[model samples]
Target: MTTLKKDSLLKGTLILALAALVARMLGMFQKIPLDYILDAEGQYAFLAANNIYLLLLVIATAGFPSAISKMVSERMETGRYEEAKRIYKASLVFGAVSGLLLSSLLYFLAPMYATDVVKKESITLAVQAIAPALILFPIIAMMRGYFQGRQMMSAGGISQIVEQFARVIIGLGLGILFLSLGYSDTVSAAAVTFGSVFGSIAAFAVMVYYARKLKKQDARLAVHSSAEARAALQPNLPYATNSSMKLKFRAIYSEILKMSIPALITSMTINLVYMFDTSFFISITEQVYTDERATEAFAALGTKAQSLAGIPPILAIALGSSIIPIVAAAFARKDQAEVNKQTSMVLKIVCLTGVPVALFLTASAYSVTGMLFASPTGYETVAMLCAGTILQITMMTSNSILYGMGKQKQTMVNTIIGLIGKIVFSTLCGYYFGVAGFIIGSTICFLIVTLLNLRLIKRDVTLHVMGKKWIPYLGAVVVSAAACWGAEYVMLNITEGIAEKLSYLLTVLVSGSILCAIYGILLLKLNIITAQDVEALPGKLRGPMRKVMRVLRAGQSG
Candidate 1:
C-alpha cells in the first residue's frame, strides 16, 4: 500500500512536470511563426489586447480553482460527496456569472481602454476580438478545478495542452490569412485575438465531457451497491434538503466567494503590474515616437520582447502549482520534516532548471532573436528581455516557496517591493534606454524581491536553507557560463551551414550537460547526494542515475 501510494505521487508529479514542459515549449514555439506574420507592430497590438484579457481572466478565476480544489478535497476526505458536488456546481455558476460581467465590461469598454488608457486606437478592435475569450475561459477553469480537486490531473493536462495548442494554431492560421488578404496589421491582430475564444470553447467542451463521465461513473457505483452497502457508499447529496435549490446555490456560492476573494485580490495585484506596464509603457513610447505608425511598430517590439522573456514564468507556474498541493498535504499531516524536504527539493529543482535555461538564453540570445524576428529592433529588444530571465526565475521561485510556507503577508510585502521597484526603474530606464530599460528594470526587481524573500524565509523557517544551497548553485552557474562561452567559441570556429547550427546546438548542450554532470559528481563525491539522496529520486530517474555511478567507477578504474 505504501509503495502504491508512493508510485501514484511520483506519477502525478511526473505528469505535471511533463505537461509543464510541453506547455512551455508550445508557448515559446508559438512565437516563431507569429514573429514572421505580424512583425513587432502587430505583435504589440496583440500583446496589448491579450494582456488585458489575461488580467481579466485572472480576476475572474484566480484563487477559485486552487481554493475550490482544496475545499473539495477536504469534503471528500470527510465522505461528504454530495457537498462536494454542490460546491463544484456552485463554483461553476459563480464563474459563469462573473465571466459574463467581466467580459461584457471589457468588450464594451474596449475603445475607452485602448484609446484613453493604452493610447493605441489599433488596440480597440483587438480588445473587442478577445473579449469573448474572457467569458469562456472561466468555465474551463471551473471544470479544471473540479477534476483537479478530485486528484485527477490528466484531464487538466489534456485541456491545458489542447487549449494552448488550439490558440496557437488558430491564431497563427488566421493571422496569416488576414495578412495575406491585405488586411491592415491591426485587423490581422484582432483576428488573432479572436482565436483564443475558439480555443477556450474547445477546452470547455472537453472538460464538460470529463465532468459528465466522472458523474456517471459515480452514479453507477452507487446503483450497484446493495441497500446497506449503498447507504455506506453513498455521498451526502443535498438533493433531499428542505431548502430550495436556489438558496442552497446561494450559500455555496457565498462560501466559494469567501475563499476566492483573497485569491482574486492577490492575482489581480500581480497581473495588474503587467497591465500597468503595458498601458503606460506603450502610451509613453507612442508619445516619444510621435508618428502613429512608428509608435505602433515600437510598442509591438516591446510586447514581443516581453513575451519571449516570459518563458520562465510558464515553467515556474508548473513547478509552483504542483508544490503547493504537496506542501499543503504535508502541512495537513503536520509533518515538518516532509515539508522541509519537499521545500528544499523544489528550490533545488528550480535552480537546476532555471540556471541552465537562463544561461543558454543569455548566451544564444542574438542567434535566437535573429531566427525569430525580421527586424533588428525586435532582435535587440528580445535579447535584452532574455537577460532578465536569470533574475526572474530566481525571484519567482523564491516567492512561490514563501507562499508554500504560508507566509502570505510577507509574500505580499515582497511582491509590493518588487512591483514598486519595477515601476520606478522602468520609468527611469525607459526614458533613457527605451526598450532595454524595461528588461533591466525587470531584472532589478527580480533580484531585489528574491533577496528580500530569502531573508524572510531564513528568519521564519528556522533554518538557513537559502544560504547553504545558493552558494553552490551560483558557483555552478558561473562555471556553466565559462563552459558555454568556451563551447560557443569552438562551434563558431569549427562548424559550417546546417552543420553550424546543429553543431552549435550540440556543443552548447554538451557544455551545459558536462557542467551539470560534474556538479552532481562533486556533490555525490563530497557527500551531497548520499545513499538517502539516491533513494529519494523518483524510480525512473533513479535507474538512469545508476549509470552515472557506473561511468564514475570506470573513470576511477582507468
Candidate 2:
C-alpha cells in the first residue's frame, strides 16, 4: 500500500475523498448528458425521481453507516474485538430486514409521491424503476460501514466509486439508445433511473468480495486476541450461540437504534432541506407564477445548480466519514489531545481548501452553469448557493465530529434547530425573490447549525481553529477572489464575442486556471498551507501541491 494510503485517519479520509470526488463527478457528468437527452419536463421528471430516491437512500445508507462505524470503533478500541464483529453482524441483519421493507414501501408509494407531492404523475415510472436498488444497498451500506470501522477504507471507497461508475455508464448508454429509438423522454428518464439497479448490483458484488476477506481477517484477529480481550466479550456470547443470542440481539438492536436514528436524522439534514426546496419551492413559486414557469424554475435551481453545488462538499463529506470512527476510537481511549488535534484540523483544512473553491465557484457560477448545462438559467441562484455552502459544509464537518465524540444528542438537536430555521427562512425568502430566495434562507439555517456546532465543539474539545492562522487563510481567500474578479473583468470584453455556452466554457477554463494558480501561489507564499500539510495529501495530490509550493518558494528566493 502507498504510504499515504495507510490506515491513518488523514490517509483514509484522502482515499475516501478522492473516491467520492470521482463518483460525484461521474454523477454530475451523467446529469449533463441526461439534460441534453431530456427536455425541460423530462429533466424535471428525472430529477424528481432521483431526489425521492436519494432521500430514501439517505434513510438506507446514511445513519447506519456512521453509527456502525462509531460503535464498532468504540468496541474495538476497548479491545472487545469480538463484540465489534457482533455489532457488525447485528447491523447486517437489521439492514437486510430494513432494506427489504423500505424497498417495498418505496415501490408501492412511488406513484403517490411522484403525482401528489412532485405534482408530476409521469415521474412514477422513473421512481419505481430504481426502487429495487434499495433492497440490496442497505446491506451493502452495512458492509461498507463495517469495513470503514475497521479502517479498511479502500474496500468501501472502491465499491462506492464503482457503483457510481456503473450508474453513469449504464444510464448514459441506455438513455442514448432509447433516444435513438425515438422513445419518449419519459422512457429515457426511466432508463436513466434503472441504472441505480445496476449500480447497486455492481456495488453489492464488490462488497461481498471485501466482506469475505474482512471476515477471514476478523477470524485471525479473534485467534490472536488476548485472554483478557476474550473474557471481556465472554459475558455477551456471540449471537451464533443459541443460549443468549436472543437477549444479546435485543440489546444490539436497541444500541443500533440508539445511535443510528439520531445519526440518520443528522445525516438527513442537508437532503431534508433540499427536499423542502423541491416541494416547498414549487408550492411557493406556483402561487407567484404559472405552473409551467414554476416547474421550469425548479428544474434550473433544483437540478442543474444543485448538481454543481454538490461538488464542493466532497472533502467535508470525506472528513465526516473518516473522522467519526477515528474520533470515536480516541474518545473510547479518552485521548483528549488527539480529539483536539483532529477537531482543529477539520476546520483548518476546510478553511484552506473549501474557502477558495467556494469563492471561485461563486465568481464563475455563470461560466460553470453555462459550461455544464449549455444554459445559464439559474446562474445567480447557484452563485449565491455556492457561496452559502461555506456555512453548510463547515456545519457538516462539525456535526460529524460531534457525532464521533458520542454527542449524538447534541448533533440531533443542532440539526433540528437548523431544519426549523431552514423552513422558516426558505419560506420567507421564497416570498421575496422567488425560487432563488430559498437557497438564501437555507444558507441562514446552515449558519445556525454552524454556530451551534462551534459552541458545542468549543465546550467539548477546547478548540480554537481560527486564532493563529486566520489572517493568512483570510488573505489567501481575499486575494484569490479579487484575482477572479480581475479575470472576470478582462474575460467579459473578450468572451462576449463568442457563442453563449462556448464563451462561458472558455471563461471557466481561463478564469479557473488563473484563479487556481493565484490561490496555490498565495497559499504557499503566505504560509496558509505548509509542507507538512502537503505531505499529508494523497500521492497524486501531494506531488502536484509540493511542486506548486516549491516553485513559489524558489521564486521568492530568486
Candidate 3:
C-alpha cells in the first residue's frame, strides 16, 4: 500500500473511532436514565422496539453503504469521477424509496412483534415512534458511503456525533418528561423513541451540508481534468463537448444490487445474531421463568449487558468501514500485495486496540456492571459477553475483508452459516442454561464463522494474518486476560466493605490500568507489534508511541 493510502486509512479510522467512542459513551449514559426512570419493564419495551427497528434498518440500509463505497472508490481511483457520482445518486434513490417502504413495514408490523413476541402492546407504539427515522437515515447512510469512498471520513464522523448527541439528549429528556407527567411506561417509551426521528433529522442536515461542500470541491477538481482522461473512462461512448461522459444508470443499478445483496447479508448477519439474542430470550426463557421475571431479566441481560458489550466492537466496525474503500481500490487494480498488506494491518490493528479493551471489560465486568446498575443479575454475563466480542471482532474484520474483495457469494454464505449457528445454539443453550447461555451460544458460532473466513481468505488470497506470530499473539491475549482478572479479583477482596457503586467503581478503574499496562509490556516484550505497525500509526500518535517504545525497550535491556 502507498503511504498516502495508509495515512488515509489511519485518519479515517481515528475519526470514526472517536465518533464511535463518544456515541457509545453517550449510549451507555442514555441507558442509565432509562434504567433509573423507566425501570425494567420500560427498558424491555424500548429495547424491543429499538432492536426490532435495528434489524429492519439493517435490512433497509446495509445493502447500499459498502456497495456504494466499493463502487465509488473503484471508479474514483480510476478517475471515472462521473461514474462514481452516478452510483451515489442511484444508491440514494434506492435507499430513500426502500427506507420509506421499510419504515411503513415496521410501522404496520409493530403490533405483531410487540404483542406476539414481546407480549406488550405498548412496545407497538415504541416501534412505530422511531419508524420515520428510517425514511431519511438510508439517504444519510449513502452520503456516508460516498464520503468514505472519497476517503473523506470526517463527514461521517461528524454526522455520527451529531446524530447520537441528538438521540441521547432528546431521548432521555422526553422519557423524564413523560414519567414526570404521570404517563404510563407506554407513553414514555414512544416519547423516548421519538428521539430517533430527531436524530435522523439532525444527521440528514449534517450529511446535506457536507454533500454540498464536497460537490463544490469536486467541481473544482474536475476543471483540471483533460478530455483524453474523460474519453478513456468510456471508450465506447463519445465524450460530450465539455469532456464529460454519460453512464448507463440502469447498468449501474444492476451492478449495485449484485454487490449489495450479498454485502447486506455479510455485514448485517452479526447484528442479526445480536438482535436474536434479545428477541429469542422471552420465548425461550418464559418456559423457565415467569413472564414478569423474564422481562426484568431481559433488561438486565439483553439491554444492560448487551449495551456494555457493544462498546469494543466499535473499533472493528470503524476500521472495517475505513478499509473497504482502500481494499476495494487495491482489488480493482489487481494489486494482490497491497490487498494482503492491508488485510494484515487491519487484523493487527484490531488486535492492538480491540483485544485489551475486551479483556479489560471481561475482567472487570462485575465491577463495571455494579457501578452502573443497581441490579445484581448479569454481572458474570457481562464478562462473558464482553469477552465474546473478541470473537465478534474477528468475524467482523474477516467478513469485511471478503466484502471489500468482492467475494460476495462466499462472504454471504459464510456469514449466513454463522447467523444460523447463532440461532440454533442460542435456542438450545437458552433452553438449558438460561439467560447468559444466549451470549455463550452466539459467541461459539462467531468462532466457527471466523475460522471458516480464515480458510476462505487463505484459499482465495493467502493472507497469513498473524503469520508466525500466532503463538505470541495468542499468548498476549491470554496473559492480558489473566492479569486483568487476577488484579480485579484482588481489588474486589480489598474493596468488599465499601458501597456497591464506589467499591466496584474503584476496582474497575484500578484494575483496568493493570490490563493496559500488562498488554503494553507483552507487546514490547513479545514483539507482537512490529516496527512497521508503529510506522503505520497516525502521525500524532506515532511520535508519542515511539518515545514510549524506546523508554520501555531501554528498561527491558537493562
**How high is the CA lDDT of each candidate model?**
0.66, 0.78, 0.77
Q: Tell me the spans in candidate 3 whose CA falls farther than 4 Å from its real position.
A: 1-25, 56-62, 69-96, 142-157, 209-253, 329-338, 460-476, 527-558
The deviation in Å at residue 500 for candidate 2 is 4.7
lDDT of 3 by residue, 329-356 (tens): 8989999889888998898889789888
Q: Residues 131-239, candidate 1, lDDT per residue (tens digit)?
A: 8887877777777677666777677667767777887789878888999999988899888878788878877877877777767756655556455543444332212
Clash pairs for candidate 1 = 44-300
Work out the TM-score per prediction. Answer: 0.82, 0.84, 0.84
Q: Score residue 313 of candidate 1 by CA lDDT.
A: 60
Task: Name the runs in model 1 displaced over 4 angstroms.
Answer: 1-21, 56-62, 79-82, 227-251, 262-273, 286-304, 313-315, 375-380, 460-473, 489-535, 543-558
For model 2, residues 297-416, the per-residue Cα lDDT tens digits are 777776677787787787788778778878888888999999988888787788777777788889888778878885777788778888988888899899988978888898899889
TM-score, prediction 3: 0.84
